[model samples]
Target: MLSTSMRPLTAHLCLALAGGAFTCGARAQQDPDGTAVLDSVVVRSTKQERTLLQTAASIDLVDGQAVERQGLQSLADVAQQLPNVYFTDFTGSTPTLSLRGLGFSDDESDSLSTSVLIDGVPVYGNALGTLFDLDRIEVLRGPQSTLYGQNSMGGLVSLRTRDPGLQWGGSAQFDYGSGNRRRASAAFDMPLGERTGLRLSLGSEDADGHVDNRALGRSDTAGWSSRFARLKLLHTDGAGGEWRLGLHHARREGGNDFFVSTAQAHAHESAASDAGRSDTDYTLLTGEYQRALRGGQRLAITLGATEAHWNYWMPLSQYGGPSGFDSRTRQFSAEARLSSASAPVGGLDWMAGAYASRMDKSAPYLFEVPGYMRSETTARVRGATAAVFGELGWRLAERWRLAGALRLEQDRRRMDWASDQSGYFDSDGDGVPDTPYTSADRIDGLRVRDSEWLPRLTLEWTPAAEQFAWLTLARGYKASGFNLYAYTPSSAATPYAPEYGNHVEAGWRMRGAGNRWDLGATVFHTRLRDQQVVVIGAGGASLVSNAGRSHSEGVELNAALRPTAGLELRGCAGWVRAQYDDYVKGGEDFAGRQFPNTPRHSFGLALNWKPADGWETGVSVRRVGSSALYPDSTVTNAAYTLVDAHVSFRAGRWTLGLYGKNLGDAKYLVRALDARTVVAGAPRTLGVRASVDF
Candidate 1:
């Protein structure tokens, strides 16, 4: 356990500012940071760090204070809270997130379209499924390819950790809840020596299943426990230069969620004889150096390495389900960056980096056939990519700024497949011992030239001291092609093409007097080409393909208002329609159908109050509209609403909280389709926690 006496970096910054004795009256209330002061209320859209009234993109920022106040479970909570973002999880830890009606096309075992990062280091595979030492999560919407690589075609979720400083401090939190849940977390920071500091953060969590599997005679749900710890060391020289190193480790094991078999679907009982199980271990090491070059020029360099191992056993038994599968994956990545900030040319800022990564994955599963026929498949994909990208922001004048970014990238993807099959019926009508298939390894190659120039232009006119309005136009892009999962085919088949899209958007942002109210809105149209999708093959095999053309257009509005001191209200609403102009599904042409899982309307509201006394309370409500589940418009999920509430009290160095998630007990489906059964949503639950700092 670490102590709670670490000093905050912000503390030194505040002290320095005060020592400077720069008198800031209402001006400080406005543009406190001369370079550009971003509104504490809005954190999305622009790289200039200006208020929402001056941005050109659509972004949703979640602060560290908000994370604590809401007691969010995972990135899932944050994703669902934002407009135009939706995600599904068969289990609490493993989730698939979507933006503006994309994402449901990748394998359940590999990296997701929505890239997830913890402190600038990418978290590959299931390691991203967990949250341990997270401080703030920023969900940047739309095409972020200009700044990020690979999956940025959809968006990116960046998780920032607390920085350590020279001081002695720590915090501890403990929680107990329904279903015999128990969790504990602690963090500490200490000054090792003059100019050197170290900090450690650790957490452990375990909980029983909330859903029951009646046919299995017990809850085939999940009971997972995990521990994560990070140690960081920092050093600074007298000349405004700094260097830091960090080491992180985490391990998790639990009964993973399993699904029903095709035969058992009608019974509403899963095929898992015993609850499933999964194990994951992750490790990361990082180093960063920063220094001032010359004449108001600054430079930063960062390097890191990461490794992770993940294992999953669905059903876990032969009798559990003939289709139960197991998977193992490992990945490695490295990046080198060189960039300068705030060069002399009038409010100009720029950054550029080059990166490369590679991965190997294999999955083997049981077949429906007995002894004479057993099958195993493995797919290995290797790739490398490099990009030089930069965003240049120019302050046109005191009331205007222009920003734009472009990236030229090339990704080469190659895959090798191997499979084993025993003698079995020729279900595909291909004669030969369809059952006992000979194992074969074959390879395929594909490359994409992804050179994109995304530009963001913003025009702001501040007519009043405390109020301003701005308009913006921005473009974003997704990377072309890559294999998201490994498959063991009897032999290698045709390669799938890449999918990418672009968004043209316009929006406005405004903030009220005294920083009491904030409102931002955007209207945009997106065209996606070569959209990827998964189709079921004979005998439980799956194949990936690309749809010809599709378009999605919508509007979104986000607002945060503090009508009274110590109380804040935040809300988001969105309406979108996504349809396929030309789609071929199940050997049929469904040219004018709506894309799957795209809701027409979604909205959420949260009310938070911190009384002048010693108490804080919060309540929230969310609603989602119905949408089709396929490009053919053959299935749909009904509209639903969910409610959550929490209350907390503080005394001395201790704080206690009582919370109930899904307070309405709303029984809704998280994922479902006519062809594919539904994965049910969680039911109502209550929990309590206590934390102390010293």
Candidate 2:
């Protein structure tokens, strides 16, 4: 039997499918040349540029124009339109992302299962702050370890920013919305010379959030403000050589009291006596040089450097006590590669690359429970990585192609940690601390080293133009790390093992005649050894541990149709079953339990229309299924649906738009730590935006 939430989604899917069938048959008889074809999207996820239709991997591409039109502000907004993707934003600095049920649920910055790339440079922590002036976003599903090394076991998100154009032009936009939200952005491009160009973009946003704090008598307790600036310079040598340099800086300050107890009657209401605060900032610099050689071959060298910092003080106890956290990270990376151009030479395509990176990080955490206890811990880590990777593709027959990729990687890390405990102690074991005590521990010169060989094989069959089918097998890996928040000496001394994944996937994609429609489906299965998971340790501290074994399997489907000129319909659905095979923690056996924070079902539908010149409208519906909040816990986040719509009018060089999100006013949980500590999702919001191009 279908649940109430599932019924609506099922109905929407059926209607979309039926409409597509009817439109396909009816449109086949019309003038094919008169109808516009779906635009072709070029992606560079595999270290090479290729059309999405020609790529032999499962990928989702989101256009920058669509992002602006629909007012998609963050990656979480974009995830709603994609299949088998989930995001949980626990705080401004800690965001958990998962693809195909493979990601960490807790606040572990060094153990991300999914990797986020900004212009080919990997980002260490959250990537939400850099969502401005984007050219496109490519989400590559499944493991990409063969090309991207570690931390890419689940998938990769690649964001490409817009570059300078040949002509001088600019655009400006302003937006106002609910909760006193305000946003302003501008982009300018200019030609410095015949062969050189430059682009600059600036944006800022501020909002008095929706959440109300009764204890503090505040209406917008979760408000936030952010600002970002980006600059790019492009120079062409006019001899098949080019040089590009980019600089980006972003900062965000917001309230850290987003979590509330689940027992509250309203998710957006809080009773905290202390209104917390958070601040984060990051700067990135990147440079690339590319040269074209003979025989359609190209050589490229890239360099990147990043520096980020985060600081926050949030209430951790019901008695209005605050806990403080501070983190700082720096990374430098360089890569050189050579690859064959888009046109295969002698029916063969190949690429080879070498990469090196160095990172330094330090974090300190202080937790206080008012008069009960206080613990402080500081950790410092230095890590280095080196890898060599290559990929080759061969034409086996007129309609068949075979490809293989391999990567040899080595990671080394050194750690220095210290922990201090003070305040009352439970000396009598009566669940009460009556004696005051103090203890301290230190760990130094601890080192970990890991080496892995990741490989992937794919067989593709192209039966017709714009049609492709492929099967792939790949291996993924994530390096080990120590627990930074450990309070006890034994817990601080322990380290988790590396995780390994074996994955298999099969997929098919096709476009209808005249490009009026398209359809794609994929099935995947993955098995993991020593899966990394978070567990509650002594003193109510969170620690990363390794699970014995686990597995995840799922199917994803997507379809799009243009029934008539100026009208389009799209739909996507996904189902996943992820469970543990053998796992025991703290004397509890959870062999067959489902993975936490992984939904079993998800679906989406969208309709876009252009009724007349200078007029556009669209609506989208998304449904997310229920899932457990923690391993072996009875508490679950219930299912919920969201609706978003937009309408715009354009005249001359000016455009105005009205958009609304979560129109149904649905209340849901985005993150939860048991029933007491929970973070609610955003509520309904409506806004208006205006933009002008010159």
| Top candidate (TM-score) | 2
The residue-by-residue lDDT of candidate 1 on 504-530, one tens digit each, is 776666657666766667787878887
Per-model TM against the reference:
0.84, 0.92
For candidate 1, the lDDT comes to 0.57
Q: Which ten residues in a row have the lowest lDDT in candidate 2?
A: 6-15
What is the lDDT for 192 in model 1?
82
Q: Candidate 1 has what TM-score?
A: 0.84
> What's the CA RMSD for each of the models?
9.0, 5.7
Evaluated at residue 180, the lDDT of candidate 2 is: 89
Candidate 1 residue-wise lDDT at 387:
61
> lDDT tens digits, residues 1-694, model 2?
0111100000000001111111210111223333435445566534366566667677776666656655666766666567777765555334546777777442453555788777777765463643689887777878886444334878888777888987999999888988788889999999999889999999998887887888888876678889999999999997868898999888888886666777552458888776677777889898888887887787878788998887777654343455767888898988888888643423877889888989888878777677776778888888898999888888767788788888888988888889887889788999888999888889997888899998989888889988889999999888777766666667667776888989999998888986788888889999999988766654445656899999989988887777887777877788888889999987878798877767888877877777887887778777888887643245577888878788899999999999888899877766555555666776898999999999
Best by lDDT: 2
